[model samples]
Target chain A: MDEVLLRAVVPTVIGVLVRRGAPFAAAEDAVQDALVEAVRTWSAHPPRDPQGWLVTVAWRRYLDAVRAEDSRRRREERVEAEPAPAPAGHRDDTLQLYFLCAHPSLTPASAVALTLRAVGGLSTRQIARAYLVPEATMAQRISRAKRTVAGVRFDQPGDVRTVLRVLYLVFNEGYSGDVDLAAEAIRLARQLAARVDDPEAAGLLALMLLHHARRAARTRPDRVLVPLAEQDRGRWDTAQIAEGVGILQAALARDRLGEYQAQAAIAALHADARTVEETDWVQVVEWYDELVRLTDSPVARLNRAVALGEADGPRAGLAALAQLDPALPRHAAVAAHLHERDGDLATAARLYAEAARAASTVPERDHLTRQAARLHAALRA
Target chain B: MAKYLLLKHYRGAPAPVNDVPMDRWTPDEIDAHMRYMRDFAARLEASGEYVDGQALAPEGTFVRYDGEGRPPVTDGPFPETKDLIAGWMVIDVDSYDRAVELAGELSAAPGAGGAPIHEWLELRPVLAEQRTATE
Candidate 1:
């Protein structure tokens, strides 16, 4: 009945309910009800075995809901036929919940939300705030997502790729709302990596760590975006960079170079540099080539152009840029960078302005606008 | 969690047969409409659902920074843009479905003659780190 024990055991109980084939919405609701009951009752009469108590109460609540829905017969049959709970040492309940939430049947959005709710034990409002949607809308989204995967077999093995994708999505949100989604994502990824030996997952974790290591230097206090080349290297997290590099090395030794692994390799190269001039641009460009081959995305190709510019020259970068689709997001911005390097200030200024107009985020727009402003100021001076 | 911007647009609905201007509405009807929105926001705030919701001014301007000697160029709120936004609500929801539900609730807000507008709201998942994450 201890508060810490309750918090630790609640997610596991929810996972058990979910794994037992309860719908996510129903399982979540039932688990929450159990927790509330525990808070009220345990304060006066503490239980000796909190986990056992929670499981008993949560299961009863779940059954009650089924009974209320008039599906008692069907649910009872399911419950009766369900496999016996794994012996305590046979499986980690928290990991099982992670796999269930990351089930391929759920869309990426739903998986992230469900995982955050069930595993992260975040409130729907908290999740909504993190994602920046109305609470009512978020509730509906999670419910619809649950309904979408209502028929998915809970016993089926989950796709590691999908699980990694969802985890990466969590980390990629960076920081928004009241939560640090990036850090949370890393925490989940660390948990996943510890529970499962997935090289790509490790690669993703490494990539995230490498990127996050530079986060302190990636933005100004005034919210201005700082390009990687412009970042102060001293401000980066060296310890995290070291851990990420080590993970990337181990993942590379697996002899399988997935896109994430290749990206991680490139990130490792970036993090290894003590200064901008020390960056192994040639190696970085080669890694980008590998990434481009694996993903074949225009964005990858565009990014490779930046690396190419560093490895070769501005002309080569521009040549690579010419081969890319003009409609690719941030094409103008990349082009401006190449033009700036090529000493065509007027063209760079114009492209910077166009890039600013095409920017998707406020920070991107501000960064692009500053580029244009810098050029204009130089021209006037 | 990613943040999303829910944009409400006055589009794709049956044309109003009884087109009464807002100023001409009965005072009680106007009061009812305002009360509905206020109550809706209050409910959301009470539930820790409120983030930032605001009715936008119909008017907008497009500004272009010219060379220092030339000054700025300005364009007004266009009359013919059929896709003009009416308002926006920013919420931090767990998933897209939650955003849709909140949008559905917002659509139930009172409008002309105290009827729910049910206007289309475009839900856009804010793309911050598309390169790193799929969602």
Candidate 2:
């Protein structure tokens, strides 16, 4: 049936449950149980009003458990607190679900798991497989997270920063199993951007969109690494690139420039070019300068060096790189590229081999090894 | 936390400080070494760090498609291809240091004279499903 629509409305149903004076943890559990049953039976007999159906089922599920434990008086109190079933199209109720999932009391891992479960409407099995964790471990983490935020008010104020961070974590983890976590993250971020006027939320959405655009060209069919300089620009998702840039431009116009906005600006510069040679490296390097100023992260500084090389010269890039620690991941590979461009093939080859030894991933190591082999073959020729 | 592969080569890697080939080692030493490796992997499993451990036969042939309708061309397993990988242990740990610690323990499996092998185990990080470098 309509799975996406069901997930989108799940938060609203959960909000209704929480608003009914159900414990946050119990309400969430009941909503998930209802969702599972909906998936199994909906194909046989789809409901005319999915949201209303979900609400009735989940609310009843919540009541059934609480009824077994409570006396008539306490049951009446909860029943009195239950809000009348209204149109589930209200965005604020869903927004509160996002906040509750990203509650500050939970660890980032727990927050990400909870957000995917509660806001993204993902089952524990799907979430566990997506993250490569055991199902039992994921279950414990989600239950623990639910318990941690059980005391949180349904309308409690939430930090947008924590919410953004949790979403970023989901986006960065990529995707596996039945859940496309990157797409899920983008969906959740889009929802977050719509509800909050926070520019950073839009900025994060833009960043995810822009980065996701180039995903196809990032690897070969056999899974070999494709360097950015060589990626086929035609393969990029032009529609997503345009949407991301437009959103980023609007967010930048808000004048509350955030880290995500700065990052998106650099990504947009890369997306704007028709070819690698046409890329606006000067602007990218400038944005990196701003990024280094804002965050002072070593990773940003390292990337800025590569952009510096394109904008200026390889020697200039090496000079910028010299200021940073060589122990940084990918440092040797960057150095090797710069040296190769500077026409020092021997040093480049050595560094490439060294970098391969330290490479974190199989494809990266293979790529670096090929670089070294290519240089050696050139010398022999 | 990231997962790493501790790759041990049958050959091609630099010789260990002990310089004792497993074939040349005494039978008791060989048994002890094998037991040590097995126990190390089991201990890792108990600690929830071991994802997998696999040993290759070192006898696989290279094969490739010849044409649209033809059978695949199988090439010789050349003796000159000296960089032969023996096996690897995949470990999930909280830090690179922990992966290294486990790799170190694996390298210290007994050699001749019942001494540590001091072998080289290449530690490589397993990248996630997509391009993380895209930022």
Candidate 3:
């Protein structure tokens, strides 16, 4: 009956099956079957040891599938040569599962799908609903992903960066249908942080926590985006912000800075402020500098320009913005803000209109359009 | 039930009755227009008639393969006179009449002076999969 408890143990159960000589693909499918059965009967006959019960049922399912295949291929010896029982020490193979699901050979979409299923323990139906895709399409994607990583060996440590990237993608998917992907990302990140010694893992967890803490104030009920400066600070989750800042402080002390840590640090600063005017723009600008140096991503630089506008003056922000390609995403929006700050309402209105035209999402376009409309009204006044 | 596409255009469609450009509309008028559009979509979703809705950016390039090992040739971001698709909504309705009624409602979204835009929307039926005929 405890869905969270069920999902949390999924990867671990899958890991246990893999160690017991089941092929990775077959083990994942078998675990999914076990999960369905658990949902059906677990409430009426709750197992005293959920993990043990899942492993037993999943292993049996795996054996039945192999036996069916054996009969077809006439390879009875393979089924007979089952490996020795794995040690019952409860070694967490969840981290290895993350690496396999996020295998470099798979496409990003495939990796994300596989990770959500094999590592996050989400059902294909749930995943499909979250993504607004047909359940059959999601199943095909997960199947393809499993096949792609079937040959992958988990003997070596996975690039923590790859796993982090996959988790980040999941987080950005936000919420839809029955699943809150952001919360799921946070849960997976917490699990990964517990197993890995990487500060970046902790940093990623902190970053998700900080961003998620502001979810309530990020939009209006009508789905219009509320700008960061305009968001109701009282709506921000104080406890989550505190947790994020504490994790970020610990990561910063390690002195091995990464992009996620730097991003988290910026988020921590924003959360630190009680109001827009109280925000430490100087520190925010500094973090943006670190972010740009670490990633050299245009997005970071564009954001840095906004911070600079607030920290120094609108001129400084506009000057920084001038260096980047005008074609960059959100470039026009940034330019509009800087121009508006510089008292050039005409230019700001024009840029806002352009930004609205180019916006990729409905909410973003609506937000930008409103901005342009506001400025145009002011100009007419 | 059959699926139909209700298409809106940035250009190439006949000029609407309320022909004022969106940028020229008052802020309140613009907000009203957006609200009308959202409410329409929400109603369709509530009735289980909505499949999908999306708005596209005005700019798009036309690209085609040039030759083996050569970069694809590309054309202009289309001119204003060209028939540019603004966006579309896909709906599964019980009949063609229902699709037309929904499209009509959508085209009546508020525009300048809080009046209906009465914009032209092209309603097209989506071809369904071939059916297996029963004996």
Candidate 4:
């Protein structure tokens, strides 16, 4: 049995049950149980229509659960009528699941977990391992999120932006587990993009694809970070970049500009360059200006400064950087880069050392430390 | 998520509020402290914050390589002036603030007279091996 195909139907089956009056939490649990059974029995007796089979098995499981739990007796009465196991319609309620899982009431962390479980079709254990949290802790977080949205109507329109943010969090967060969360986030984003008419959903999918295209070039064999400018351009997946840029262009043509689109535009520009010197820094700076105006985020402004340095000169970048708070993360690193470009070895070395001290991840700290050491050695020579 | 090491010093840290030596404490008080510690670990595990906790033996030795031909250089089970850690707990939490909150809770483990120890625990972040995609 194809596991991906099996997992893909999970949200659809759950959506069917929820629409039929089962609680979201119970429906989700039942679908998980049905999925386990499918793994066990599908080889012997493969279902002709996978989604239909899943809906039937999952619905039965839901009824059994409702019967077993004393508190669900009233809900059990409501769903007692068993409709014939006809093939589930192509009507996609998975979109509703996306909105429910990313409900605004849930904390950002909780929202991410719920989205991974409910829409991404990942198990609690998988999510816990991905997040480096205990299974019990992750389970509680997911259940709490489910409870928070338990009362929400299945058809109530969800905030598309909230769903996109949750998906983005899943994509960007680091995880060293069996599951590739970046891939999972892309899968969910793709599904959302298809179901929703919003251009931002497409934009988010485009952004994820663009970033994912460079996964191989992002690190060294021993897992050291390779900064974008230094990464081997040949290592990028051209096919993925083509797809991302294509989608981005379509979304941009709609003229519904969003931060994700702006970010993807920057990523596409980087991908377009074969060498560091060939990068269209002028266009990158323009995109950053759009991003800064759209979000007014300090980090965006900080990044725009780096592009400005490349487009104009190191002095111009430093002048722009000087306006921002020095305490912002990576501020020292950016300052070091611009100073080094300005031919100020001493200042660059000092800032590199400071950046290394402030680095959060081991690889980044090592990379910055090496940069500092290299500058220091050159000064000595 | 971030991992933090909560270090409990045996001798180096400034005295806690309930500063009486463990040996000087009544047997019941000792039991209470131990019980409190056990419960704390259990609670953290249930909440999914706990990674590991361990108590270290007070006696330790220092060793270093002498040369390619020699066995090694050895030093004393260091004196009281030398900082010795009593124990350590590793926790994976969501934020620095949460780590601080948990460390504060751990410091409140019962001590002599069954009062909060209020010990100073050194909290240090464990450098993450994986870099986030956005970074």
Scored by DockQ, the top model is: 4
Model 3: lDDT of residue A62: 90
TM, every model: 0.73, 0.76, 0.75, 0.91
Identify the runs in model 3 with alpha carbons over 4 angstroms from their true place. Answer: A75-88, B1-135
| Residue range B1-32, candidate 3, lDDT tens digits | 45788999999899999999999999999999
Report the C-alpha lDDT of model 1 over A17-118, residue by residue, as the tens digit.
766667667887788778888888987888888877877788788878877665555755454443244443324567667777887777676788888777
**Which residue pairs in candidate 2 collide?**
A360-B125
The 10 consecutive residues of candidate 2 chain A with the worst lDDT sum are: A79-88
How well does chain A score by TM in each candidate? 0.87, 0.92, 0.97, 0.95
Candidate 1 has a TM-score of 0.73
In candidate 4, position A361 carries an lDDT of 84
A204-259 per-residue lDDT for model 4 (tens digits): 99999999999889988888788999899899999999999999999999999999
Report the C-alpha lDDT of model 3 over A1-381, residue by residue, as the tens digit. Answer: 488879899888888888877889999999999999999999899999999999999998898887788777875545564556676467788899999988888767678888999888899889867766556656776777777787887555788899999999888877755788888999999999988898999999999999999988987676667888899999999999999999989988999999999999989889999999999999999999999999999999999999999999999999999999999989999999999999999999999999988775567777889999999999999
Writing each residue's lDDT as its tens digit, candidate 2 over A261-336 gives 9999999999999988999999999999999998899999999999999999999999999999999999999999
Candidate 4 chain B: 10-residue stretch with minimal lDDT: B126-135
The local lDDT score (0 to 100) that residue A253 gets in candidate 2 is: 98
Single out the weakest 10-residue window by summed lDDT for candidate 4 chain A. A79-88
Name the runs in model 1 displaced over 4 angstroms: A1-11, A18-24, A34-57, A63-89, A93-96, B1-135
Q: How big is the positional error of residue B89 in model 1, measured in Å on the Cα after superposition?
A: 7.0
State the C-alpha lDDT per candidate: 0.77, 0.85, 0.86, 0.87
Docking class of 4: acceptable
lDDT of 1 at A74: 70
Give the Å error, residue B42, model 2: 15
